[model samples]
Each structure stands twice: as structure tokens, then as C-alpha cells.
Target: MINYLHREQILPAPIEKVWAYFCDPKNLNEITPPDMKFEIVSGGDVKMYEGQVVEYRVEFVRGLRSLWLTEIAHVRENEYFVDEQRVGPYRFWYHEHSFESVPAGVKMTDHVTYAAPFGLIGDVVNAVWIRQRLNGIFDFRYQKIVELFGSVK
Candidate 1:
């Protein structure tokens, strides 16, 4: 399996504020890069209760489109949420999002474990570019958070 980790801190904001923003389905497109053209096709509920499933369609570079369906496995209000892939671009995808209250603000952590469809070939591709692409997604998300919340410091 391939793993990716991302961490960010938003200053002067409580965990609830950050959690609310992230859990809102409408904000998914806002944080995604315009190049990807990510859009939620179903399950646009703003509140993430357990067992919620969200379906999304993404247009990759050159109009390559893929459908992703994810289900919320676990949730702790203002604390953490876990989403596992029911169907998506990858063979396996599980993301854990956690929020911790800090003196300055909220520290958010994203842990993603995924695997491609093909076996060895997929591993090689992930090692080379897929991992980097995942990181880029997080980088875009970080900037979006800052834009939505304003500069922390």
C-alpha cells in the first residue's frame, strides 16, 4: 500500500471551525485544484454522520474522468473523521483526518493509505508520480484553508 501524510496548522481558530469547513461537501471543490475539476455528484450533505457516502467525479489532465465513492467510517465531532473508499480511482483508499486543539490554533493531520489497481506496475508509478500528485492535492488544500480562514499568524 502507498501512504501519504499531510499536516497543517490554522491559527486563531477552534477545532470546530476548521472541522466544519472541511466536512462541508460543497467545500470539496473549493479546495481541489481547478485543473482536476473535482465535483461532488452525490451525498452533498454538509454534516458527516457515520455511514455517509459521498460520490465525486474528477476530470484529470486532458479530460480523463474518474468516479470516486467514499464512505465515512468513523467520526468524532470536532476531533477526527475516517473515510474509506467504497469505489474510486484507486484500488484501495483510506483517509484519516484528525484535528487537535492547540494553544495557537488547531493542528490538522491527514493520513492517506492507498494502493493502485495494478500490482507491481502500480507500485512503481505510485513511487514515481502518484505520490507526488497526492502531495500536490494536499498543498492545494493547505492554501485553500489559508484563503478561507485568512493567515493564521
Candidate 2:
């Protein structure tokens, strides 16, 4: 299993504001890396009520394009939300996102647990470069959030 943690601070923003950014499916492409060419193929509804399913098409490294689908497993308004993969690149994917109102701004956290499709071979590939790619994607997202929301401090 691949477990990852991501955290960010959005300055002067309430938990609701941060949550809005996350729930809006259209904004996903804004936060994702441009190089990845991410796009939502279906489920464009911005309001993520419980049991919503989101489907996306993403171009990987300019060569492969894949369809990814996830279901909104749980949601607690501005506090937290969880999405589990129904079908996608990974054999298993569970991502939980949390938001907290801090003194300075809003603290956002992402915890992802996933397993690649190809078992041992996929694990090896993940160790070599997939992990780094994932980090890069998050880095791009962080920068985009900072651009959209400005510094929290």
C-alpha cells in the first residue's frame, strides 16, 4: 500500500472557503499540474453531496490517457470529506481530505492510501518515479492554491 500525507495552509480563509475550492470539480484542473493535462470527463456538479461519483480523463506524461472514477464516500461539510476510487489507474485508492479553521487561516490536509494495479512491479515503479510524480502534482496544487487564495500569514 502507498500512503501519503499532504498539508497546506490557506491564509485568512475559513474552512468553508477552502472546502469550496476542493468540492468544485471544475477547479481541479486549476490546481493540478498543467503538464498532466487533467480533465473531468463527467460528473461536473460542483456540489458534492454524499454518494456522488466523479469521472475524469487524464493524459499521463503526454502518452497514455486513462479514465479515473471516484465516489464520495463521506462528507462533513467544511470539516472533512473522503473519496474512494470506484475505478481508476490504481487497484485501490482512498483519499481523505480535512479542513480546520486555524488562528491564521485554514489548515488543509490530504491523506491518500492506494495500491498500484500491477502488484510488486507497480510497487517498484512507484518507488522509482511514480512517487516523485505524485509529489510534483501536489506541489503544483500547492502553488496553485497559494496563487488563488494568497498566503495565509
Candidate 3:
């Protein structure tokens, strides 16, 4: 079954600043949890653009390292970008990052749609593990972003 996660955060920063930070593929490692050992294997040097491909290595399941390949499917400067998985542990993964200027600052939203592998077993795993793991990852990201960009208050 397909699963979805949506999150929004108001960052105390200008849209251009937040957009610049997110546009650099390398910044992903900065926001990701260090325990995951997330590393960009290649294709992370330049700013994100439609058709850009990025490869990464991360320890996700049972601490086993896995390779993830993704392509930037769509990009609208200072607005939004979508990335789709090409090769990864998941059966399918699509993530959209969007930004809007709010009275407080920049409102950033993350929308993720993904499906697990192994059918019924995958569903069970997601129910017990993957779901929480993904939440934790995003939680970490939120904290890191706040630390880097300051709080909305």
C-alpha cells in the first residue's frame, strides 16, 4: 500500500535564503541524522534542477547500508521541487518540497508518498518500523533546519 507523510514548518528566514539552502543538494547531509550515516556518493555538487540525478548511501534498515538514487523530476525556482526515486529500498518514493512566503517567514512543506517492498510484509514493517523511522528522520531535519535558520519566534 502507498503511504504518505506531510509536514510544514515556518522558518524564520527569507524565501530566497531558504530556497538557496534547499537548492544545494549537499545540504541534505547537513539536515539528515548523523546516525544514518547519510552520504552523497555522487551527483550532489551542483544546485538542484529538473533532471538532476543524485546518488546516496544510507544506513536505514537494520543498520545495513543501502544505495539510493533519485532524480529531480520537477523544479520551480523559489517555489517547489519534486524528487522521485530511481533506485532505492522502497518500491516507490516521491517527495515534494515547497516553499511560500508567510508573515512569519518562509513556510516550507514536505510531501512524501512512498510504498514499501515485499507486499504484506512491507506493510507490517512500515506499520511497526519504517513509518516511525521516516518520522524520526524528518523530525531531525526540522531540528537541524531550525538550528541553522533560527526559530520562528
Candidate 4:
């Protein structure tokens, strides 16, 4: 069962600043929820560029470690980038990070399409837990972004 999630946030910063911060692999740790214990296992210093691959370990399932690997499949500098999961729990994971210049500030959007491991069970999991967990994760991310760059307008 494929599912989608979208989140938009206005950062009180210029597009260039926001783009640079988000495109840096190091800042990923800063925006991610601390409770997840997210850590970059590889490509920590590598810049977010097309073809760049990053590996991370996150304790999302009850403090158990899970490995996730992603590749920068597409990039339009200062505009948007797409990261596709190469190896992970998800059957499919594609995330697009887009930024636009607005009068108030930069409008950043996160668009994700993913499917869990099991089929029918995955659908149930998404409904019962995965979906809610995703919402919580993104909610945390949104708040952290606001804390870092201040709220929009």
C-alpha cells in the first residue's frame, strides 16, 4: 500500500540560506527528532548532490537500530532535491524537498511517497501506527525548523 505525506513550512530566512542548510548532510541530524537518535553512518561530510549516497541508523522501533540508505537521485540546486531509499524498511521511499522564494521567506516543502514492508499487513500498520508515527516525525521536524530559523512571518 503506497502512501503519501506532504508538509510545507515557511522559514524566516532567505531561500539561499535555507537551501544551503537543508542541503548539507550534517544539518540533517539537527532537524531530525532527537528521540529517534538519528545518526549518519556514512556520507556525513558529503554534500547533498546528485548521486550522493547517505546511510543512517535510527532507533525508531522501540530503541532497536535500523539502517537506512538513500541516494540523491535528482537535484536542482537551490530549488529541489529528491532522495530515494536504496535500502530500508520501506518497500519504496521517495522524498522530494523543495524550496521556493516567497515574500515572507522561503517556503520549503516535503513530499514523500512510501510503502511499508508487508502488503495487507502494511496497510494495516500504516493505518494503525506508521501513518501516525510519520505525522509525529514530520511534526517534530517542522517545529525544529521553526526553532532553528524561527517561525514563518
RMSD of each: 1.5, 1.4, 0.8, 0.9
lDDT of 4 by residue, 1-153 (tens): 789999999887998898888889999888787888999999869678899999999877876889999999999988999999999879999999999998899999999999998899989989999999999999988988888899854
Candidate 4: segments with Cα more than 4 A from true spot: none
Clashing pairs in 3: none
lDDT of 2 by residue, 16-130 (tens): 7778878887888888887777888888666887898999988765788889898999999988889999988888888888888888888788888877779899888888877
Q: What TM-score should be assigned to candidate 4?
A: 0.97
- CA error at residue 145 for candidate 3, angstroms: 0.6
Instruction: Compose the digit string of candidate 3's lDDT tens values, residues 25-64.
Output: 9999999989899999999999998999999999996579
Provide TM-scores for the models. Answer: 0.92, 0.93, 0.98, 0.97
The parts of candidate 2 lying over 4 Å away from their true place are none
Which ranking of candidates, highest lDDT first?
A: 3, 4, 1, 2
Q: Which candidate gets the maximum TM-score versus the true structure?
A: 3
Task: Estimate every model's Cα lDDT from 0 to 1.
Answer: 0.83, 0.81, 0.96, 0.90
Which 10 consecutive positions of candidate 4 have the poorest summed lDDT?
144-153
Q: Which stretches of candidate 3 lie over 4 Å from their true place?
A: none
For candidate 3, the C-alpha RMSD (Å) to the true structure equals: 0.8
- Model 2 global lDDT (CA atoms, 0 to 1): 0.81
Best by lDDT: 3
